[model samples]
Target: MRALTVAEPGRLELQQRPDLLATGELALIAPRVVGVCGTDLDIIDGTIDPAFVSYPLVLGHEFAGTLLSPTAELAAGTRVVVEGIVPCGVCAECLRGDTNRCAVYDEFGFIRDGAAADLLQAPPHLIHALSENVSWESAALVEPAAVVWRALTRARPQAGARVLVVGDGTVALLAGILVRQFKPAQVVMLGARSDQAELATRFGIDLFTTDADAAGSGYDLVVEAAGAAAATAAALAAPTRGGVVLLLGYPGAEKVGLPVDDLVNGDITIIGSFAYTRAAWHEVVELLNSGALDLTGLVTHRFALSSFEDAVATLRHSSGARGKILLDL
Candidate 1:
């Protein structure tokens, strides 16, 4: 089997490896589609926290695959998505249903080999079978969608609330799309790329602009997904009095300045969300199964496993309305 391996920081290659076999309660999965994001770059560059990643690792955490063998109630040929974060169910945090913070930092594409390969090994408990109607491309997005879902759930936006999403990337776009589930009064996207206007519109955003200041403030809910220090400051200033600001982006390790006076005087609430919880993942799966969410249009690019270099290049140099880019394994 051939897999994309990051031998170390600033190094990536397609390496031939032995086929993975299902052992114990784990399932042998044949990966079909994998989604790459900005975080993957951090993993490749060794910029992410050392505690969360291991070197010589596989580079995909968001992916969907076909079950190569029957596992428990699931039959062979079942399409499925697995949770990347592996939690120790006996831990205190896990007992409280906060599995994302379960003390164990183990995860696929981090501590273990990821799904950017011909074969992947995942525990059965973490696998959720996709319904027949769901497309493989959409299934590949469950991981990122779950991350946004958890953040929105934590923010708890009220009905008819005005929403503002900052960033043109997939995470930011997904946040704009998912916020519609709460029936917001209006949803506007503040992005940097002029080419992303069409992509933002496809996500049901009627108003998409490059100027954040022109988008105006007074948003009931503001999401910062650009992952930049300037974007972080803009997010804090965009909210109205008593508005909720959700930080869904990664601003690296730098300390970003905040408007303490505005936060205190405006009664603003800023929430910093990490990864998705087990419950959040399940909810996203249910939404897909129920046909309440349609993500098929989100896929804008595709490539074969052999075209790994091209795929990475596209992700870095996207010039148009780019959405999710998938690796067809």
Candidate 2:
């Protein structure tokens, strides 16, 4: 089998490795697609905490594949989306149904061998079957899409409520679409790029200026899909008086102080939605299968395995892209 190994910080190389065989409760998959998002870039840029990373590991988590071998209710030949995170079931948080908070969380690509290879073996429970019509490339996005679903769920916008989504990436775009289901009177995306503004138009959301303006426009709800400390602050600005703002993106170590005066006087709510739950994942699948969740504009670039370096480079250079980047095996 072939794998992309992260030798250390700032190093990713394609290498030959023993084809993964089904082990313990794991199954083997004929990997077909992997999506490159900012999280992937975080690893490549060495910004993520090293405590979450193990060197010389296979480095892809946003992927989909056909099951080559299986040992449980999940069968061979099934096309599946990789869940990528295999939490220790025994954790206290897991017991509380907060597996995302698992202390010994085993996240693919970061802490373990992931699906950047031709054949990847992962826990059988992690392989989510996709309907035949869904392309592998789209299936690879289930992880990120599930996250959008969760953030919307956290916000719980009501029909006819004006909404603001602050961010300019695929996650923000997906969040804009998902919020539309609630029949928000208007959905506006606030960010720095006109490029992302074009993508928001494709997703049927109107583009707005800064986060505070989005909020000052009197939106009933605001979704803070941007993950940076600066962006998070901007997201807070997007919420109106007595409105709600959700933080959904990967913010790294960035921190922001809330407007205590607004919290008290305006009654604004700042909600943070983290990694997705299993139930949210299932809901995302249903939304995707129903044809309402189209990712047609999500792919900005597709690269061969040999061009992994180029793939990562575009992520840093192509800030203008509105959609997710894909790695074709």
Candidate 3:
């Protein structure tokens, strides 16, 4: 079996590795499409927090795959997407349905070998079977979709609310798309890259602009998905009185100056979300299966497993509008 292995920070290669087999309650899967995002870049450059990452890891978590063998309830070749966060089911947080906050923080593509390989193994309970009609590209996006879904579920934007999404990346685009379900009066995106305007429009964004001031203020809901301190600060300032601000991005150790007076005087709600819970993952899978959400158009690039270097290069620096970059295994 061949796997894209990041031997350490700043070193990545497609190496021949031992085949992974299904053992115990684990099921074997052959990853078909894997999405790479800013997190993957952080993992490759060792810029993410040390506590959340393990070195010499496979470089994928957002992926869709097929069963290499039948499980108790599914047949071989069944399309599936698995939850990245492997929680301890016995933990207090898990008992409370807060699996994202499990005391034991084991996750795929972080501490565990992920799906960026010919074969991967995961516990059957963590796997959700996808509909046969779901495209591999769309299924591959379920993980990240679940992340955004979890944050939105927590924020609970009301109908006709004004929403502002900060960032032009995949997560931000997903946020712009998914926020529509709440029937917001309008969805505006503040992006650093002008090239993303067309793509944002396709995602149902009413406006996409590089100017922060043009984005204006007084949004009922503001989502910060750029994973930057500047974006975070903008999000905090965009919300109206009693508005909700959802922080869905991971900016690492960077800190933003808080508007303490405004937050207190305006009665704002600030929510910082982590990874998705099991329920959130299931909901996203249901949305994909039922055709309520279609994200295949977000896929803009694909490369073969052997072309891992080229994929990383494109991910690091793409001259054109980039959405989701996938590895077709």
Candidate 4:
């Protein structure tokens, strides 16, 4: 099998690996598409928390694949998207339906080999079938979409509320797109890059601004996806009194000052959403299956697996409107 791997921090190579086979509870899969995100870059650059990642790891957590073996009702060659977080079902958190916070910490593309390869070995219970209507590229995004879905569901913005999404990255763009289902009166995006206006507009964002101060405040709901300390602060201030602010970005190990007094006095509800739970993943899959979410035009870039270097470079130095970047197998 050909796999793209970060052999160590700051090192990446596409090399041949031993054939992976399904054994016991595992199932073999041929990854059809893989989506690379900022987390992947952090993995390659060794900037992610040391406790979460292991060396010589394959670099894909967002992907779609074809099942190589039939399991239960699913047929062989079925299109599928496997859950990245492998939860220990018996754990206390898992039992409570908070699988994202499972006591056992194991996830694909992190502690285990990911799907940035010709073939993947996944647990059968974690795999979910995709309807034929869903595009392979769209299916590849299920993981991240599920992440955004979880965050948005947590905040539960009221119907006709004003929503503000901070950041121009794929995550932020997705947040703006998904919040629409909640029937927000307006969805405004605060991005750092002026070039992202077109992409944000395409996602149906009502307004896009690069300036946080001029972007206004008192939003009914605010989402922070820029993964920066300043953006986090902007998200805090953007929400109205008694409104909700959701933190979906990862700003690394650095700590940022928070307005603790304002949070208490303003009766603000702040939530830090992590990975998706089993229920959140199911909701996203249902939305995609029913065609309620049109993921079209969201994938603005594509690269061959062999051109992983170019893909990584583009991610680091992208200038204009950028959406999901996929590595096609």
Candidate 5:
């Protein structure tokens, strides 16, 4: 098997490795599409938090693949998307259905080798079968979609609510698309990159602007997905009094000054969401299977697995409209 391995910080290689065998404990999968995000860039650049990453790691977590062998319920060659978080089932958090908050923070593409390789293995319980009609591009995004879905579910935006999404990246775009299920009256996106305006509009966002002032305020729900201090500040100020602000981005140890007085006076509800729970992952898969969500068009870039270097370059410096970048196996 050929794997995109990061031997250490600032070091990455597509190395050939021994083939993996299917077992009753772990299901073997041939990854067909692997999505790369800022987190992967953080790993390659040695910018991610040390506690969550391990060296010589495989560079994939967002992916979908085909089963290599038959399981008790699922047959061989079934298309599937597996949950990346490997929660300790015995932990208090897991026992209470908070798998994402388990005491042990093990996850694929971090502590464990991920699906960036030609072959990957995951616990059968974590694997969810995909509908035959689900495109590989859309299936590869289930992980991030699940993350946003969990946050939105927790916030529970009401019907006809006004929403503002703070970011133009893939996560922000996903939030814009998923929030529509709540039947919001309007969805506005504040993005730093003007090139993303067309993509945002394609995702059904009512308005997209580079200027925060042009975005106006008084949103019933504000989603911070840019992972920047400035974006967070914008999100905090955009919401109406008593509105909900969902913080979904990771700013990597950066701290933002909060408006404590305004928060107290405005009676705003701030929700900080982590990764997706077991239930949330399942719900996202259900949405994909039932045809309620189709994000294939969000994939604007694709590179062969062997062309990972070019993929990383595009990820870092693409000047044009960019959405999800995927590695095709």
Candidate 6:
């Protein structure tokens, strides 16, 4: 098998590795479509949390693939997607049904080997079936999609509620669909650029400027998918007096400071959401197949394992691709 490894920050190297297989509880995953995200960029640039990672770490988490070997009702050759979060099942958080907050949370690609190769290995618990309706490219969004899906769990958005989604990334784009699932009266997305706003329009989401009052007109909820401090602040300010600000983003390179006085005065409920939950993952798969979230235009670029530099550079550019950039192994 071949895999892409990050020797150090700003360095990518392709190397050969032994094939992986399902043994005991783990499952073998063959890389199909992998999405390039801001986190990957953070890892590549050495801005992510370094306490949990060492050099020569694999750099992929958002991906979909096939089963190499499995006996837990997952047939070989069946299409599948990777959940990417590997939590210690024995931990109190995992035992209590909050796997995202498990004490031994070690994210794949960040703290463990990930799906940046022709063949990858993961626990069966982190794998999910991909419906025939969801394409491999769109399936790469399973990880980030799961991020928003779980954030919505914190939100519990009611029907006819006014919602605002901050940021213009693919995760925020998917949040629009998730908000729509709650039957919100209106779902608006704030983008930093006009070109990117066009993509949001295609999804039938009202696009507004980052500083616009898209969510300021007394929104019931504000979903923060952008990890920037400014975006988080905006999410806090977007919601109504009694609304909740559900945050799904991780600020890898910066710290987020909240206004306690304003928070108390506004009577705002701030919810911090992390990785996916088991139920959220299952429901999001169905959402992809429901024809409600159109991901056709989301996948923009593809690069082979050998073209890793080109792939990373494309993601680093300001005028980046519409949604996810893929690596085919």
lDDT of each residue in 1-329, candidate 1, tens digit only = 99999999999899999888988878999999999987888888888888989999987999999999898879999999999999999989999999989887789998998999999999999999998889987898999999999999999899999999999888998999999999999999999898999989977996999897788999999999999888888899999999999998887776789899999999999999998999999999999999998788898999999998888999888688799998989
What alpha-carbon RMSD in Å does predicted model 5 have with respect to the real structure? 0.9
- Those runs of model 2 whose alpha carbons end farther than 4 Å from true positions after fitting are 208-216, 250-255
**Regarding lDDT, does 3 or 5 come out ahead?**
5
lDDT of 5 by residue, 50-76 (tens): 999999899899999999988888999
lDDT of 2 by residue, 1-329 (tens): 78888888788889998767877877888888888888777787687778877776888988888898865777789888877678788878888867677788688888888888898878877667887667665687888888888778878888889887777777887888888778888887877676676667876986555445443556788777777787777666656778897878767666688878876787887787778877778777777777767666568789988898888888878766448788888
Per-model TM-score on C-alpha atoms: 0.98, 0.93, 0.98, 0.97, 0.98, 0.91
Q: Each candidate: what lDDT?
A: 0.91, 0.78, 0.92, 0.92, 0.94, 0.79
List model 6 lDDT by residue over 255-295, tens digit each. Answer: 77787887898899989887787677777777787766546
| lDDT for residue 131 in candidate 4, whole number 0-100 | 93
Off by over 4 Å in 5: none
The better-scoring model by TM-score among 4 and 6 is: 4
- Give the best candidate by lDDT: 5
Local accuracy of candidate 3 as per-residue lDDT tens digits, 1-329: 99898899999888898898988878999999999988899899988888999999998999989888788888898889989999999989999999999999999899999989999999898888998678888898998899999999999999999999999999999999988888999999999999999999987899999899999999999999999999999999999999999998877688899999999998999999988999999998998899888897899999999998889999999888999999999
Off by over 4 Å in 4: none
Candidate 2 local Cα displacement, residue 146, angstroms: 1.3
- Kindly give the stretch of ten consecutive residues in candidate 5 with the minimal lDDT sum: 249-258
Angstrom error of the Cα, residue 276, model 5: value is 0.7
Candidate 4 residues 98-134, lDDT tens each? 9999998899999999999999999888899999899
Q: Which pairs clash in model 2?
A: 211-238, 212-237, 215-238
Rank order (by TM-score, best first): 5, 1, 3, 4, 2, 6
